[model samples]
Target chain A: MKKEKGKELVAGLFSLLPIILAISIFLLLLTKAFPLLSLKSLPTILFSSAWQPQKGQFGLWPFILGTIWVTITAFILAAPLSILTAIYISDYASGRLKKWLVPVIDLLAGLPSVIYGMWGILLIVPLVGKYLAPLFGTYSSGYCILTAGIVLAVMILPTIVNVSVEVLSAVPADLKEAALALGATRLEVVRFIVLKKSRPGVAAACVLGLSRAFGETLAVMMVVGNVPLTPTSLFSPAYPLPALLANNYGEMLSIPGYEAALNLAAVVLLFMVIIFSLAARLYLNKLEQRID
Target chain B: MGSRQKSTDRRLRRRHRAEAGFKLILLASIILVAIILSIILVTILWKSLPALKLSMILQTPGTGYYLGKKGGILNAIVGSLEVSLGATLIALVIALPTVIYLNTYLKRKSFLAEVIRLSLDVLWGIPSIVYGVFGFLLMLMLHLRASLLAGMITIALVELPILSRALDETIRLVPAELKEASYALGGNRWQTSTRVVLRQALPGLITSILIALGRGLGDGASVLFTAGYTDRITTSLFQPVATLPLAIFFQLNSPFPEVQERAFASAAILTLLILIISLLTRYFGRKLSRHKVR
Candidate 1:
């Protein structure tokens, strides 16, 4: 046992080296970059409304608002459709059909985000411009929050459906049988027993979906019109934090402290994602506990 | 009595139709997503039709659109292949050991494992643009200019979270009985891990690697600052390299139609590559799981 323990210790130390190195490098970079800008300046940089790089004024409020708007729009559009579809697939579809449909969802989820962005650029934006924008107003840019939100919804649908379906499918067979034996209809059983049991998982799925929507950069950047202003309407041009960083980093090289500010923005975004995913993990843990 | 029974049957038939309607809507959702994907594919092909001639694939990028003389995306394709493969290899080397450590020696340290898992999840959630900024700063600090080496290292960092989680999950999925049997034979922990658990998890690990490769190959923004675009292919890892996705991004904003068409063609190629890898990984993963069951 002692020899086995020694071998295990050696193997463990070896395995941890790479992860430790990667994390330390990231943290070291963060530390080096942080002192360039004062902590007192961070709030204005983050919360102030204006962002003119030429004037050396940078406020992240508009970008934050854009991110929140697009993500919320995506969730609102995707959540109901995803939940309804998950319910139908889990409770109503035949076993054979479910088997085939499940893989399609998986495939959609696995497709890289860049491809989705390309598709949005080549097809969806033009179609929206040609058809949908005419109804809104002549001044409306075709690639606006609506276009991005719709594409984001499509991108996040598979994730939501996959998780919700798994949760709904795991609703105890005995509960369903008991409901039916009590003379409750199939729809009633689904409405009450299955959904109630799977609520946490479904909620977790929605949070995960929101997380993806918020973090999505490539597709939204391609179609978001990327104006650095707070959007007053769905058709107004805007910029999210990710897009702002991506679009300006190359040209901002001559601007003093722009790089450090961008890094701070990134750090903030990373913190938000950490909080979101931690909430999701906690929800999933609670669901698992309930299941046990 | 006969009339009452007939009414009951009709009511049952109507209820069944409503259930069928719900199913139809669900199926329609799937079809809708598929149609959108197909439309994107068709649009790319349509846009790139002018550049679909054989020479476009074989020739190099040069000045002037010489109709049939316009060179192919040879350099961009080769560069993508090199950088993506290089990054995947690096990520695998890093991820494999981390996964093994988490699954075995650190298994008892649930708190630490949870923290690691949470960090990885957050890492995956962080936007690619953030990675670009981080990479640029790190490279500047290290005195490494914008080069393939910087880009590859950045991509490897971005991919580590997913790859590690995949490896960890697959390692955990290895049957406890297998490890116990190895231990009974007087095999050490390293022996059990490398010989038994790793062998069992190889297929899943390969799937994870392929997924990471697909992500790296399709990445654009993260490498934009780290690896500036270069048309001429170079052998040195410390030089600029043009990749397919970056080519697409650059071409989209270009004034030239030919360049834009080439971008579409490149995007088409990337989309198909990712789709193919995704399908193959899913197939192999299923096969491996089935093998385990037997």
Candidate 2:
């Protein structure tokens, strides 16, 4: 009996590890970043575009704006297509196509971000610089906000599609069949019953996709020409928070206040990711539990 | 009556046409996605074809390797494998017990389990860069340099949530009757978890681990700061290690066209590794029958 109690205690302690980790991560970043908050007002750091770290001006608005532009663009591009693909796979696709799609999407989702980054550099960058930008009456050097958005949209497609498909699949078939028997067209049945029922679930899927885009590092870093300025146009280069951290975290030791500034950026990114992901996770969890 | 019937027919025709049109659009989206996936694969293959040599895998980068001169990426390949494998081992050791504890010692849907699950989900969603920064700060406090060991521990943190959440899903599928039967046979919680639940969820456990391993192997940002890149392969725990993603990253940034071409080749190798892991996952996932005796 004593042995059993010990085993339980051991396992229980391990279970608390996740909570402990979460708190430590939050506290460590917040504390390291607290000095910067004290030194610089929150509004100035968040709103100013001036980012000369050496001159004691450490505005992060450009990076924050860049993250927003890229993520929103990716979200706009991915959300509808993900829903359409999910609908097709769960409803319209034939057996053969369905069989192929599950694995193909799995492959897309599994391919590393580095591969996507390479693809961004190799294909999207050139396409944007040479063709798309010019069509829009502008010239880009190929590394720009739009290119990053395109790459990110492709990268996050599988993540959204997989979840959306599951959400769509879980819609009770009986409801659809009943709607069909009432003389509803197939699309009407889907749009009215399936889509209606899965709205919140699909919204959660898109939110999770947004969180994913906001946090993506290497792929966005590669294509998003890391110039520290607010992105005025899609063809302009921009820097994002994750890229800022990845690019400057190691070399910032020589500059005073730079480490704290970077830590604050990480904290900002942490908040963004946690807020979006937690909302989606809780909503999805509730939906699943209700069903169960 | 004739006019009314004709109007109703027109409405039906429009609705049917609308249905057909909408379905076609949806079909087109799926087709576009497939084409893009194919294009990505083909592009990687085509770009790397010239640089894909057997020696590329067998040898390390030599002097002036970045100058488009001589050598391969064996250092990165080994380093990536070592870090990911190491992280996987550590995560599994910790995660399996946490999962067992959740499913057995705690009541289903207990408040503690709910909080644990929620926290892990949030951790899983936290960007890898935050983990990188966290690990870097920890290393600073300990006066440790960027190295393979630091990378492993950092990645292990990233993998922990992934492993636990995924394994949680798999273990949840184990029927309650099995546990009840184990207890009926005089098995305690430990015996049921080890002797029964472990046996039941092995395939799924492996599958979840593979998924986490794939994430760890392919991840670049979390280890970017914790494990600074190196051209030379070292078995020492304290020495900086190279990885496939960073190798591709650095090589692609090279001015030399030859070096740039090698970047594509590196991307292809990384993609191939992940592809194999995904395939293994599919195989094991299929083997993970939802109910053993239903």
| RMSD over all Cα atoms, model 2 | 1.2
Candidate 1: RMSD to truth: 3.2
Estimated TM-score for each candidate: 0.90, 0.98
Error of 1 at B163 (Å): 1.0
lDDT of each: 0.77, 0.91
What does the lDDT come to for candidate 2? 0.91
Model 2, A1-292: lDDT tens digits are: 8998899899999889888999899999999998888888989898989999888888999999999999988889888998899999988888998888999998998888888988998899999999999999998999999899989998889988988888998999999999999999989988999999999999999898889999999999999999999999999999999999999987766676788899999999999989999999889888878877
Query: How well is each residue in B37-126 modelled by candidate 1, as lDDT tens digits?
Result: 566667777877776666655766776542323677777778887888888888888778667778776763487666666556656666
**Reference-based TM-score, model 2:** 0.98
What are the TM values for chain B, all candidates?
0.91, 0.97
The residue ranges of model 1 lying beyond 4 angstroms of the native Cα positions read: A1-11, A14-40, A181-183, A285-292, B1-21, B65-69
In CAPRI terms, where does candidate 2 land? high
Output the worst ten-in-a-row residue range by lDDT, candidate 2 chain A.
Answer: A250-259
- Chain B alone, candidate 2, TM-score of 0.97
lDDT of 2 by residue, B16-66 (tens): 999999989998998899988998999999999889887788889988889
